[model samples]
Target: MTVQTIPAPAAPLRVTPASPLFLREDEIRRGIELLYFGYTAMIRGADAILEAQGLGRAHHRALYFIARQPGLSVGELIGLLGITKQSLGRVLTELQARALVEQQVGTADRRQRLLRLTKAGAALEARLFGELERSMARAYGEAGQQAVTGFWAVLMGLVPPDDRPRVEALQA
Candidate 1:
């Protein structure tokens, strides 16, 4: 039997350079729309994977952060996610129930709970990240190095000044 191969996607349209009046309302709206749509597209594949596992974006976010810092505390996760304790508690409970995560009492503070991923959790996180990395790599390759740097700068500008340190710490 002959095998069939799907065609590659068409090249993206050429994006116009920003006008001198980039601060105008139309330009700002364009930026906002692009950000919303771009993010939605980027996460679409991961969302499907999460849905198949009976999970949601919040669960994915928790898995990602927990993977990033294996011994992340419950309080620190709440802070990083900027989510309510009740909301996080629900997500963590579900994750633990699925044997995807484990929590241990902090060595220094008996009252504190530190979070870590199970082997299963790590596998799931890696799959999710693979989907994201593929999308990002394609976009970055299309945009090139200079545009990628500018994109990072624009995203950083969106973060509050006080939160910059927390974000910067992740780079280390």
Candidate 2:
């Protein structure tokens, strides 16, 4: 007797409010306001520390991402940060001068520069993350698991369709 294999069923479509359905201006405005406030609140802690170090949000963002992705190429950073080369060059120069970051020529491609954080950079990144974590932890704890999951889905949905894969890859 010969046995045939059965294919698994396809996943069901997920319908969300974020879908391309019509939305009221008032609702959209509310979401925009919430995003503004959330962003401001999240950065406030890190901003204080960065300010004291003569750094700004841009510097902190670079440090945070570099710490997340060690040995990331200069081009990769520019793509991820979505900033102009000039802006990134300025930030990198500052970071290099401070000895917080180091760059090495890629083995495979001599022209490509791989970026890594120094011991000092890691320590500062940890300190910066600590403050932000405290705030997020408190908010997440209050929101509970379900809300947290939904919140992440909403945030991820905000990313452009073309850029979603890149952002999701970073999560991995």
Total clashes in model 2, counting residue pairs 3 or more apart in sequence or in different chains: 0
Q: Clashes in model 1: which pairs?
A: none
The window of 10 residues in a row where model 2 has the poorest summed lDDT is 1-10
Residue-level lDDT tens digits of model 1 in 10-107: 55435888999999999999999999999999999898899999999999999999999888899999999999999999999999999999999999
Writing each residue's lDDT as its tens digit, candidate 2 over 127-149 gives 89987877777666555556668
Off by over 4 Å in 2: 1-22
